[model samples]
Target chain A: MPHLIVEYSSNLEGFPEAHALDALNATIIASGQVQYEQDLKSRTIRTEQFVIGNDPTALRGFVHAELRLLAGRTPEVKRDLSERIAAVLRELTPHPEGMLVQLSVDIVDMDRAAYYKGTL
Target chain B: MPHLIVEYSSNLEGFPEAHALDALNATIIASGQVQYEQDLKSRTIRTEQFVIGNDPTALRGFVHAELRLLAGRTPEVKRDLSERIAAVLRELTPHPEGMLVQLSVDIVDMDRAAYYKGTL
Candidate 1:
């Protein structure tokens, strides 16, 4: 199984609706790759704000979404999971014109030594 | 410019000496890519421990080292940087036999919108 962590950066904050998180969770579950279903999980999205320019009065912040999944270790499976995540994020927050949204995905291969019984 | 995050998983903890972090910082500075020089930086290394088996008492934890670098975006440059990091980590922590030391490296392309004034 793999633990996936998706980190995204955007210029908008406090605009993502509550359903956005739900939609992300649903997308992952629907993929039929992860085992845990009862407890659909999410971390408190942390934002780091910055000023792009003083004259334009532009502001930007990064929102990182970390999702832990237990799945098989295969190249095709990893690619599919990454695409699904990118698609979900695009649906959740589409950036404005002249803006950039960067998404970085990480997969942790959970071996026997890395598995735990209780919550982390 | 790119922000690099190196996540490594191993089966040993509380064994890495204090100089390990210093060695990492020194390697990055010696790379001569990052601009900020006065403040050699590092975050507290966090560990997540797990047991492989009760009888053997095999334990594992993950060490994530995040480094921010500002350089021109080029494929060769990126490759060189990644290889340099992998080498440094290898020197820092060499794993035992039959154990898998997984290292996942991520790079954040810092654009105009993502630049900040002060510390994050």
Candidate 2:
């Protein structure tokens, strides 16, 4: 299963949550690397308070994404997926006035031997 | 670096964010499995909208914690840490009225060669 979690600043406006999920899901499906679409899970978390860099007085915005997948993909596939995700975020997230905006995507290789899955 | 991300339902009340963080950090430090305190990062994310299981008619609460660290720890250490985290969650999270509450902890081994880290 590949789980994508997006954490963004609550101050950011015009966030298209549904479109972003579809973009990510489509990217993953187009890659043809994952096992199945049913295993994909994506969601966004809006953070109310956060700090960026060393600035304490100024407000900043960020959209940081984390992708967790069962280990076995080549570096090229991971890189491509990450680039696609970053592109989606860049397209969806609007630039704030007088604020620094940063977008980052990280791919974490989940250990198959250690991961446990069960249905509730 | 070891990062701990806690995602809980926003509908849940009486959440002790600071105390929970301190408890988790202390548990990790007490285990003495990680390198140093500087390498640890912990934060909570309150999700507003979420669905659990097949029940769309009822509200449910969940506390899911994820710990990411450099690969090298034994299974015993991971299990111990997970148990400690679950204990923290169980003790801290209040059971909502007539709602199902579930707690889960997962330890993800971050691939050293694949994980990219940089200062913002």
The C-alpha lDDT values of all candidates are 0.47, 0.77
> Clashes in each model (backbone N, CA, C under 3 Å)?
2, 0
After superposition, which runs of candidate 2 have C-alpha atoms over 4 Å from their true positions?
A: A55-59, B1-46, B49-72, B75-105, B109-120
Per-residue lDDT for A1-120 in model 2, tens only?
Answer: 567788889878877776777677777767776665545556788888887889788868999989888788889989998998898899988787987888999998875655544322
- Candidate 1 structure quality by residue, lDDT tens digits, A21-88: 66666787788776776455653333322212111233333333444444344656655655666566
- Candidate 2, B13-36: lDDT as tens digits: 877888999999998888897677
| Candidate 1 lDDT by residue in tens digits, B17-116 | 3445445555655666655432333323334444433546443344455554433557666666666766766677756656645554444443232222
Q: Chain B, TM-score, each prediction?
A: 0.63, 0.90
Displacement of the residue A96 alpha carbon in candidate 1, Å: 3.2
- TM-scores, all models, native as reference: 0.45, 0.58
The alpha-carbon lDDT assigned to residue B39 of candidate 1 equals 34
In lDDT terms, how accurate is model 1?
Answer: 0.47
Sliding window of 10 residues with minimal summed lDDT for model 1 chain A: A47-56
